[model samples]
Target chain A: MGNPAFDILSILPFAVACSFGMLILLLEVFQRQTASRSYLAGIAVVGFLLTAFVSGSFLPTGTARATFGGMAWIDGYTQIFTSLFCLAGALTAMIAPRYLQEHGADRGEFYALLLFSVAGMIMMVAAADLVVFFVALEIMSIAVYALAAYTRRSKLSSEAGFKYFVLGAFASAILLYGIALVYGATGTTNLAAIGQAFGGDVARGATGDAAAMSTLAQNAIVAAARGADVSVAAVIGNTGAGAVPLAILGATLILIAFSFKIAAVPFHMWAPDAYTGAPTPVVGFMAAAVKAAGVAALFRVVSVALFSDSFRGGEYGWVQIFFALALLSMVVGNLVALVQGNIKRMLAYSSVAHAGYMLVAFTAVGFRGGDISMGSGLVFYLFAYTIATIGAFGVLSWLGSRGMPCDNFEDLDGVGYRYPWIGLAMSIFMLSAAGIPPAAGFIGKFLVFKSAVAASAAGGPGSGLLIFLVVTGILVSVAGVYYYLRVIVHLYMKKATREVPEMPYGAARWAIVICAVLTLALGVLPGKLVNSSEQAVGQMAGRADGVYQQSAEAPLPTPGGIRLIR
Target chain B: MAETIFFIVFALGALGFSAAVLIAKNPINSAVMLVCSFFCLAGIYVMLSATFMAVIQILVYAGAIMVLFIFVLMLLNIRDDEIEAPRLSIHQGIAILAGTGIFFTIALSIAAWSGSSSRVAHDTMSDTFGTVEPIGDQLITSYVLPFEMAAILLLVGIVGAVVVAKKRF
Candidate 1:
């Protein structure tokens, strides 16, 4: 391995974000009590821009290198998601200052906590080991817990924070138990090493060469035959039968934990209250960056560590689990969202529905030979959802004032006539969320469904299921149109029943305009981003194969009874 | 034979104390029973040859945490009559049934696996295994990333505690 000092370069984005976080906290200490703290958001935005720049610099090379002794990976997948999270964080910072001030809860620690949370998201997406992933997840989660309760004067905010903390801690405990079980089964926490012990190379060879025993397995057996190792046999043999149940159970638990983070159905009981009670800008960050981080973690753990021929199909497969979750989330989220009068709560349920749509792409990834396109589709869809959802929440925060919070559908009456720019931005976001044409969400849905159809055409065991899921998603999204349009109807047609005071626009207006424009731009011309997303997934898959090849070439048994290449 | 006897004693003590911790009416008695449970768990850790873990379990949980818990209990000085005894509801019944089902399922699975060839035999463990030195080395070396990240987590936790608990900023 190279010098450990060089590994710091791989985490430069995270370091930059953390340093800015600390700087903001320090600045908060020296500032006069009455002095405006708005510059903290400016500093936080600049920090995010620098982080995005550092992450984007890695995009051209798309090099897949494991750093931090294989505890983290520097690759296109990590770089892309890191930049996306930076964008989301910057937008949230831009939207936050005025909203916080309006509520008389303006504090410098808000920006610091936001920066720290973004730093955690960066580390989490790049994490290659379970330990790194878990720690980074806590770093993200704890900061968010504090941010949710940032406006401590409100009992609703305090209650939201308490509920999120309790549930999140429970989820973390379950996740840790899963990691422990997986380590017990595979003898290592390193994802690549776990892949090796899970007989991924053997399963891959079985698919290619049609061999009863893969050549790699033969090589391992031959090495054992020469008395080089006995544990190699135990590793290969046990994975074939004995440890499979434990491994599957662990994988299932991990999936459940991530589902909680992503707010999938059955595990989404906390989303509505948490979303509605938290500060609007913070909700934007949570809906966009936090959920994207969860999806990124799922992509790594499920696609790299647990991906095997056996794990992809059959009764206990993760694919089936995701299918059930996707179906339930889409139906329940959309149906529940229809009746909600509170715009924030509606968006919360809609976000759950969006999670279902992403899980559709996720389920497609598990099918044989569907990884690349489906993976790209999932990435693109997340970007689309992030921008639109953040924009929606930004507008909500923009409309709200100290005593008069604009949360209900009725609050938007005559808004289109009153503030044309905000009304237009809201319309664009609503259309995108509803997946109307000429908006980013439409293109995102098209890409995901098209990829699913293409995968089905490629003819796999679950081809029929894929087509059925696509059809179901399309039909359910039609119901989503009514609620989305209702916002526009209220915006344009209804008269203001009360004297809604006009609020001055600030940095939040810029964030909304940017999100609206980007949504349209991406929808109209998606070729460049689609290509880059495809390339990123290709590089990710290449890294997985490279790890498998490395393990295949050297089956050397370490004292831990597993071969780990650091 | 001696190891098995110790194992049985420690496991049974842990289970009994845990049950007592749950069932005890007085908050002080429950906290004390929780300490006893922690001590028994530490004993089991010692039997598993995780001496460092055993020591920390006793030192941290029994010594520090239990002391805090007892202090809180005493400070509160809550009367027994003031606290309503929790009546078993449908939710509680369902929770109990599900918990028992899961416990038995896991216990049975472990029993089956222990008798099977798939169970990894850890007879070849190095003498340095579970010791403080190697774990400390690992914390600085291969696990340095997580170790550093945990510092950030704790920082966030401290900040979170202040943000949530502080009366005024």
Candidate 2:
């Protein structure tokens, strides 16, 4: 009983990652005298790094348990998300001081809000129950909404924050409705309990499903068609091993909400406007931390809980819809980025494209064969994406110095010649993002291709998907090469119209430098990082007897929810 | 009979107060009305056997957070004229149509469609079914960490809010 709630701890890293900011805030608000801002920044960075180290330490132990009457699950999947959230937060915190002091917008509360937001993110990732999840989502979102509009003077920033809040609320409402449907269908809010309920329905088969009682849960109708209790011959609909179709619907709604948060295509309208409009450091956090949580949690919710039962009879719209979105994101993200004159908007599109690439791997999750390798590929891609995105934003922040908002491609003109170190770092970041070798991005994409190919090689029909992904992969990367290079072109070829931004010798630049170095390190040591991710993925999909249940039983959408009254 | 009466009063109260939020066209009035609507929601929560939820609805939301929102509105000194600031015709119309359509559709759909429900026929609160004690039990044990974490998060949020909103910090 060391605390089944340790899953709660698994998600704690993100919050802990932001504690330094809070400490700074406490002094600013309560002490009447605040610590030196630089000192506070140092504390924040150190604290975040420490949190990262601690959370990373939790990865190897594959312990799973139900906490407090099954309200939350602390498991390997939770651990993965916690690690990703903390890593993003720590990196952002490390960079914020320079980012803050530069714009004259960085205040003590900025750091505090950042920490509070991170804490909310941690709780959200670990929320096992729907209510808890909704609460946590709000906690995380409101903090971000504020951060998005942190600069009071910037009309664009305020507008971006307002728009994000409005749309985000709309998305949350959809998600809540979906959650309501799920509760009506299953009569439970706990994910594990939902599984049990579905499992029972499946065990009882078609008769139990159609004949069951519980007017409050009309769609749990699978219950009513038979006798009030059970009969031996009620095994028809249980043809599959699980209640998947309904599960799929619930998962899809979750996907839409998560997609909104992460900024995937079709679902990505808010991102470019938001990113271009928000103050820059907030962009860094949103791009890195918000997207990381979305992808990580998506992988967990879909791949772990639902995958146990779903993926059969082609009902989940799994292969086709995801493939389309992924393809669209990849092609559209790159294409749009190319046309964008605003560097921030360009980066926003690049994120969309990167999300597309990640979605491409996620398609593997929906592909008939539940190949564990694809999970690893997705994780690798995430790590690579995180580093590159952060670095890219860092350089952008550097470009926009002393109340200067970096608005257009022209803003970057002549920076390569003027600020060589920072320019070179940005080049590395852009190249890595474009999947060039000797950069983390290339290794990540390579791993994904290899994994998809490996699964196809194993005599499964993943070959069709493999081919489609490979072709798109090559095509999108080629399409992507130009936009990234365009920045470099602006940096080197164009004349410096403004005074060469005296190489921003600050914490933010150092942060960008560190991330660039790590990108290379990951490229060089792809094996080590890949192995860790592979192991984490293995732990995540948890060996339910080593056999990848060739066909899983899934629940279809109930067509309706619980009939609350008889 | 009591359940029916309670449901009517609370539901009507919620609807009425929420309507006040919308019809007033003033952000401050809307926020205060929202607080009243929240109280109605808490009443509904009580009827649902979610006693603690009702308390939290009132305490965290109506009691604490709404104050922050109103304070911000007052501090910003946003005038009545500024409240309905200029909007792009296309964008503003899109927002209005979308919002109206959604609210109307949801109300219509719920009215037309009778969804499934779980019957908690047993009416009395015992050791379970949402008393302060049960919620307390669950919070400390199952939701213990999240409960604690929520407090800490709120604390951080308070500090952050002061920092961001306060001129000096």
Candidate 3:
């Protein structure tokens, strides 16, 4: 019953964040009521910095391994995402003290919940088992729900919390059900096992592919193919036809669940209200870190389980579903954002559009074996998005007070001239978000678009789809310019409507300056970062083959009460 | 013939109780009907020879959860007339259509997969696998992490309840 100390080292970042959170929560009770809350913020900042350092240290030097009986993984992908989440958490912590003081909701649990949620996000990225992933997702979601309602004084905050909880629970149920069905088909919940279950000739010998398989399986596969506009007859004619039906059905269910998490077009309805109603710093955390975790999970799950080699080059595939979702999200998100009056809501729609761009990159990976640069592009884009968004929200948090939050377009009128520093930073964020030159967002978008073009020009089976997405994505990004430029115009041209105190700030101001500088720096000198990102992705590509080798050596449990004795 | 009759009775009872829970205007009636439905579900579980699951179902769903439901219902003291029937609208109509479509699609998909060798066979179960002792052993051994996580989740639930329901710390 002793602890597995050696194995636990792989999860050092998660452990650090969780223990730091518990320490903060315990100290909150013993500390004097009159004590400055900034100390707690300082602890959170240290925790995040330490976690980021640990994650960075563990980045793949050329190896990838799953520990804890395949429940968690240590790899370059996990390292990159872990660092991003911790950095986001740190930045949010820096902004929270000022925002909470102005809003009259300063409490220790706020920082505790933020750290706990960051731990959950790190765990999510490291998860190698479906159950671990589900647990981590729930932990993150529950803390966020609590944080959303942290302000007891505001009815809007409570409403936002309740709505998000109800919708999130519904989505979680759908996702768990999908996991159950997949477990049913594959007889295992381990990502590698599920991947092996459906890949190549191995699937024919899998438990579910026996001659006694029901005709209904064929019917469902046909229905799925028809739904995706693929030829059902051609798919049924293939070898391992019996396994395809269940894989298709399970993947569809999982795709639906992931769509909600990523806030794709139709599932994005709750995002605006959730973002606008929460405290500004929490909104930034959710917008940046939460979105990063979701995207990472999507990539891991799709590549590790759902898109095995046998499922490729098929008449029907999950890629087509993702392609459709990405196309709709880009078109709808950009178009609707143009009319939003609330800054938070506009940013929410923009987040959805950004998810679309990432999905386009993800779908393109289905073509040409696996595009390492495209995958790395996704990581880079998310990092850029996180910094810019946190900065934008930080500026909003700075300008707002308890009674009169500067949320609307008119609220920001002439404030730019009044606070030149904040105005210039906000302008930089707006430019980055619009994919304008000399900004990180532009570089991010260029890399993603370039990947899509590479996939289409590679002349694969799904090249046409990638081509269409790339074209539409580029055009929609141009439309994204309109709303972003409008923010700039309002900041500079409009007259100031109200007078506000111009007081020197502490941590929040410093945080905003750091974010802006990083955004600009990454844009101006992208070489080193881009090279690291591609290297991380290269490590990922090599790791897939490594996983198969490891699984071969391990004793694998098969379906039908069969076990391999090594 | 006897097995078929038994299955039909259990299915009908469960479905009827579920329908009653949905249709009952009063919250108390709905709670009662839900308890009845849980019993029927436990019966179905027993029919599948998952005796441990059936016992847990009765203990957790029918007993403990129902008591909590009744406690909340009594505490709220909502008036009977306040629970009015929802009027049919375009939104409702579309929801119904979508629900039916999704249900049929899932049912068809499940039927196809089940007909194949994918149907998990309970007939081959090891005697100890379904028994209480082995289940307990496995819960403490292989599933110890999940069990501990569940304990933490319950603790969180308690803390959250205290934080939200209390007017002041």
Candidate 4:
């Protein structure tokens, strides 16, 4: 509260991206109508690089601090995800210009919207309050909706944009309603306050007879005596045991909304159509940065707000819900992907399967003492998945031209012989995505599944469920190998029946090479990223207490539940 | 007792108009029905002592937004025959059933919880509670981050509107 300037500085990465977005829009207005706007892509890449640079500076510090009146966290997890998003944005920008130019849709606003969306993403992962999270999510979704329809001349693109906007808006409404319910039950949108209300130890500390006073009523008395707002105190006191059901419903709604965002099964009907119809590079961004942001926010909210003992492992636990989603997304995604002829649609399903894999790690987080490694594994998997997906889509955009989109498997026939470098890069991406040996995806899967196995080995009540999830994940991933390898087969073994058009190797080639090298490097020497991810998750665990002190200011009267940082 | 009567009247009006909005076949009629629903909602808000919210609800939603919606409906210039006849498809039937089930579940839960001892009496609130000043103060102070972010959200919305609607760059 004393340092508003520091709060502004804490959001430097978001500000930098927003400024660049505005700069691009302004530049677009001044440019001649007939002139090429490809340089705008370069400017956007530069913007992303600066954003990454600013975020990266925070990585080594390993500090977790709440800023902006406790609305956002400047923490290792935030920095890591922000940097990852910037990388995704930079790669997408590099891959976009040539594709956009080719499709006669090369407008500077594409890069502007890309920057605006990335800015939103940077904030989304960093948001500590549900209000900030919702607004940032809208900023990201709105920009992406427009980006999906950037090629408005095409009916498919327009349809994709309209469908995504409608579904996404509906999901946002559900999320807002959930937030409202949680606020009604807890009387605050601050995540830490909600966590304090949900935590079990505070309920035990009340002086009144345990049977007479509800846990929420006890906490509300303690909180009110500690100088909480009267309105908040009143709402919390009134809800009593009823608050639990309301909050649970709210959390479930929020989880459903996030599942839609991450393209989990039962809510993933939009992914195939949107990915197939969107411009290629935009698809790469959606598959990479957008999914990463969704997963990041999901982890934050689940860990900070809903990780109470009662909430983590019971009949109504999120772990059980995530386990079902993971199983369904993996099985259904892999199975549906096998039947898809369009490469983009295939990858879209593959992305769903990858989300399932991430959820496998997410489910492990609920097991006793499994959070650090499982959380780190989730991060590493996202990094691996983001780069590999973007690279795969980059290769598709590279091989495409004005008339031929190069979306089908046949379009890739004998591409290995025609363009060896692009083919090799595509092979590496495909290999990584399939979780094959000597590739990043393999290491990511290994880390995640290994943690799940280790958690199972600990022999808890839900250990058997964790083992089942891991086994099911591994089996479904084996099914996933067929479609991923099919791309490589088309690249090398098959002969082209229809001649594939050759496009110039532009900045997209460089982006592909970068992704390929990073994929292999992470696979071979994952020590740095693995250690950093662990450090990030560790910071997250340590920072939960910091959030309480920052928001509440006065020390919480409850003795046992929270370790106040101050 | 008077407050209870007002609450009942506004609540029933809001729900009835909302259902009418859905049932109206003409696009213009539906738009007007929606406007009526908004006014009833604003009345409820005012009864809850949220004068600022009620005023803004009427101004932004009922007055301005409804006008724009009506303008668009007029511009589209659709005849009554152009509207699809209400048909109970299986999907629509299932959706309606699910909606009713959820509504009843929530209503029952609220009804059960209403008997709890800790209900906040309306007189407990401060005189300035729901006025604009306190809201503006909260918006600029603790909630400033989201307030600023909302501006960015609006900017993005505007940009998105132009990007999707513009025929040519």
Candidate 5:
């Protein structure tokens, strides 16, 4: 307990960022006696970049280890997601000071809140215990709730904040209830313990119809058996209870909560309003980082915790649900976006469609009979998605003045001529978002779709659906190009009428350029990213040996943690 | 036996107060009842053996938060008088619909799959409920953030109360 983060010192970068954020707050508060707050801003940026590099080093080969007495865990999956979070945080922090200072809302707390949120997200991915997970989620959420309404006088910002908070609370409540039920079913709040519960089913021949589960189940039972139980039969009964429908309900409720985060269809009511109403820089943060974390968490929880033939009692039915969600999201998001006049709203819908593409990667992750593959592809896709989205939002933010808000198609009428680099970077972002080649988004979609095609050839339960997914992926992408190009059409195709009010060429320009470069870099060299993903998939599947295992960071109280056994 | 009684009482109290809060038209009354609801929740904590949390609930939520609320009401002293009416605004409608959708989805979905076998047979008395010592030990060691939130909450409470209490300082 001396250093709670010591067990997973690999995640020290996240902690350091959090500390840097606090220091930024303190530095700004006392900077009246010293030089400019810009110095502190530079320090924050440098700290984050160093942290980003350190985390990136971990990405070459995913290392799965637990830290802080099993409270926080850093494995291959956590490594990839944490890297994504850090990069997004770094990008947002880079531009935030100048952008916020331009409008007079430039407080040190803004950076602190952003850093804290990133810290929250990092812990979220690494959380081995329910308490830690929930706390991490809250820390991230509360910060953003304020950020969404940062523009106090703007009625839209206020309304957006209200809508997001209320809906977010409701979803959080549902998620908590799900956690309670999962704890009830498994008796252990520890993920490692929960995974082992699946092994228990394999013990009593509860493998249902999936013979492929035998190996995972055997390994899980062996791993779970290593941990002493206060009540053996209770543990077995809970394991046996996996055959019950409550497990599915728990998984579904959790899914519903995550779907909201990813802005997936049906649960995506909050995203457009929140995105459109928020200030542009905050919108960039939401579109890129918040949404990425949501999807990453969904990937971690659904794949690692639920989604098994034995656990769900032969109901590995998310293949169709994901298929439908992907199709519906692509169709609905792209279609609605085509008619949208607001540029930010259009990008929000584009973000939704991007979620669909990622879902395709997730769908391809598990084989029909249940072997997993192309996990690294999903990570690469996320990395691409994060870079491109943040880049798009940054351009939009720069174009938007405090009064104008840069939302409508007309806002960018002559923006391309005024800010040529921004125009090109935004075009690249739009192209990448549309899945055009030579950008990260293109390669990401390619790997995801290729894996889906492979998954289909393997003759999973829904080859027909995978085929459908593949077709819609192409068709939906065509729709995506239309909306993305509409902005391009406004930018270069149309001529500027009024003088484009230009700010000093400083931080925003640099951020957009860096984002554009990263997008291109990721597009060209995605091997390391994919390898990270591969390691992550192993850790996620590694827990399949036993659902949840206790590590140093988060140790489960024998009776308190696992209620299914009680 | 004790736990069963505690569960029954706490469950009833939680449901009843929540319902009252929902139905009550008076904003002031609603706020007061909400405080009561929090107290009842603190009672449930005693049953769960989280004594420190029980004290925290009554002192912070029931005592401090409620008084601050009352003070604001008196300070404003709206001419509209003792009974504050509730509005069925769009937010309320959205809230109701959302709550209903979630409740139906969860309740009906679980109901459909509830196999007729009730496998819930355990000796509640025999189970050694986690004592405050362990809870404290765990909170300090593993849950330091949430524990630190006590200070944040106090800070927020003081700041928020002051901000609201003084129109402009």
Candidate 6:
């Protein structure tokens, strides 16, 4: 309402993505029909790189300021995730042209939709309002639904698309309903405003100290009563007489929607079909960028808006739900993945298990235990997982280009000796996915586990829960090894039962090489990434403001204290 | 007293037509019943003082979208033999039970819940709150971003339809 140009740079990533998407659409129309698909993909790559560069610039600043009338937060957390998403988009663009052309669905709309989805992801990471977040989510979901069904000629693809669209639409509706309920309870859609309402007078007092936090338990009820028009006594007694249950119910419903997006078990039934039927490159994009976007959105909501210490003490809580989902996702995703013969389906299930690992970090953050940073570990883990997934799917796409999709394990028999480089790239990706030592996956897991252990040691609420998750996570890693190594064994040990096609030189090959090298580098020298992640998470936590940063907004009460953002 | 009698009659008609929509054997009959249901619902909206919404209910749902539904039905033109006989399964029974349970729970809560009536009272509200001009003003201002985004979404939908349904691209 003030300056039209105020903080316009905050939206650079989204603006870049949107403009590029439209540019690609226009280019498709104006350019010759026979213009190389790779050229179009190259434009997309340039767009992503530009967006990444813009987001990356904010990393050094490490600011957590709100912009767009507080509808978006320009912060280190969003910036880093923005980079992760852009890198995924760039890689997808690099690998997609070949896959789309091979499948006879090469069209300008594919790249356009990819960019649009990427734009949506960018918007999601930056969104600070429920309305904005929901719109961004739909933007991403709709584009992805089309991408999943891009191969209209294939029945399997159409079915996958239809299933994903219907289910995704239902999830969106539920999410919207939850948003409506929360808005009803809190009377605001802005995360900051909601946090302030939840925090009440304690939040406004703005004294940064441990003593202030001791009073938080007592004051929190008063705050909830004031904010939500519910009685403090009723809330403390858990009599279900007020908006507390309604807020929790709303949050839980939203969490259910997020669980569906992250492919947590019980909500992960659609992933196998969608991932298997989608083109190889598009599946990789879904695994990497789409999952990252979902996690980003989930983290923002749970941490910034709905976070409250008292919410956990009640019979109904988000923490318990997260803990249960994490354990189930880990065990079920791994055990069921072990039985899958289709490689894409296996990877899809593997993505679910990976989501479980990130959820462990999410749970720890929600517990607000220890000195461990909140979102950095989750961000790093997603980054590492994205790299490995992209590389793995790149190998599949390479084979797909040669007219052999390698959909099932049998199709990859003896491919190792015949195509050693692709075999080697795929092996690294598998090893990384397995969380083996000296791979990016292991480093990501290490950081995540370290945070969980730290949280447990902090001797706060849910310590035992965090400890149990860490132990189970370690055990699940062993199970992960067997499935991942099985793929490697199929590569080297099994002789060629089917004719191994010659490895072609193209964007997919380059993408695989880049991703493999990046993954290995992340594993071997994770110091920089780890430091950056910690810094980003610390900034998100508001530690940079010399106050404890909990999941809530800056102007709201942290578990330890209140730090005003001025 | 007259308004109350009219309300009960309209509500019953809405419910009956809705049931007919669900229970009709022929697709054309179902479509007609759905139109009747929509009109009855619009009547309820008007009684509730949401005249704009009531008008929109008829214009959009009954007038435009229903035409599209009938056109598709006519285009398909499946023979009576082609339609499968309806059969109730355990799954359907469970779903119906769950739906009814939810409905009762909501109804009971509304009946039982107290102390929020003062908040629900909007007698102090602006006269133009639900009118067309205020809504248009807000849509062009506060909701401008979403409005633009929705436009882009529709454009994407058009592009998607072209790509998905076009025979030769």
User: Each candidate: how many clashes?
Assistant: 0, 44, 5, 0, 32, 2
User: Could you tell me the lDDT of residue B45 within candidate 4?
Assistant: 93
Question: Each predicted complex: what DockQ?
Answer: 0.45, 0.16, 0.30, 0.48, 0.24, 0.20
CAPRI rating of model 6: incorrect
- Model 2 alpha-carbon miss at residue B16, Å: 7.1
lDDT of 4 by residue, A1-566 (tens): 12232367888899899999999999999999888888899999999999999887744466666776567877888898888999999999999988988888888899989999999998888887788899999999999999999889888889888899899999999999888877765656767666666554222222222245444456556655555443444555544555566667777889999999999998899999999998889999998899999998888888777765444544357778888898899899999999999999999999999999888887887674325446788899999999999999999988887677788999999999878888999999999999997999999999999888987887978889888888888898898899999999999999854444444537888999999999999999999999999887767732334332343443332211111111
- Cα-based lDDT for every prediction: 0.79, 0.66, 0.74, 0.81, 0.68, 0.73
* Per-model TM values vs. the true structure: 0.92, 0.79, 0.89, 0.93, 0.84, 0.86
Q: Which residue pairs collide in model 4, if any?
A: none
* Candidate 3 residue-wise lDDT, A228-277, digit = tens: 21222222222233444555666677778788878887788889899888
Candidate 1: where is the Cα deviation over 4 Å? A1-6, A58-60, A200-240, A369-372, A497-505, A541-566, B71-77, B118-123
| Global Cα lDDT for candidate 6 | 0.73
Candidates sorted by TM-score, descending order? 4, 1, 3, 6, 5, 2
Please write out the lDDT profile of model 5 over residues A1-566, one tens digit for every residue.
23244344555766676667667766766755333354555676676676666666744443455555455566667766776787787777776666665555555656666777777787777776666677777777777777776665577877887798889888899888878766655555555555455434422334343233333234335535655333434343433433345555665677778888788887788989999987678888888888878777666665555544344222546656677777877788888888898888888888888888878866766434234555457778888988888888887777666665677888788778877888889888988898887888998888888888887897746677788888988897997799898888888877775343555436777888999999988888877767767666666522554333333334333323322222
Error of 2 at A199 (Å): 5.7
Record all residue pairs in model 6 with backbone atoms less than 3 Å apart, i.e. clashing. Answer: A303-A551, A541-A549
Judged by DockQ cut-offs, is candidate 5 incorrect, acceptable, medium or high? Answer: acceptable
Judged by TM-score, which candidate is best?
4
Candidate 1 lDDT over A1-566, as tens digits, reads: 11233378778899899889989989999998777888888999999999999877834455676666567777778888888989999999999988988887777889889989999998888887888899999999999989998888888888888888899999999899888767765556777656554545324333443234433345456766655544554444333333455666677778889999999999999999999998889888898889999987787777777764354444356678888888889989998999999999999999999999988877777765325446788888889999999999999999887778889999999888888899999999999999998999998998888877877787858889989998999998999898999999999999955344544437888999999999999999988888888777766631345432223323232213242111
TM-score of chain B of each: 0.91, 0.71, 0.91, 0.93, 0.62, 0.85
Which ranges of candidate 6 are over 4 A from the true structure? Answer: A1-7, A31-35, A58-60, A196-241, A312-315, A369-372, A401-403, A460-462, A497-505, A541-566, B1-19, B32-59, B88-117
Q: Please give the lDDT score for candidate 3.
A: 0.74
How many clashing residue pairs, candidate 4?
Answer: 0
Interface RMSD of 4: 6.4
Distance from true position, residue B157, model 2, in Å? 3.0
Error of 5 at A72 (Å): 2.4
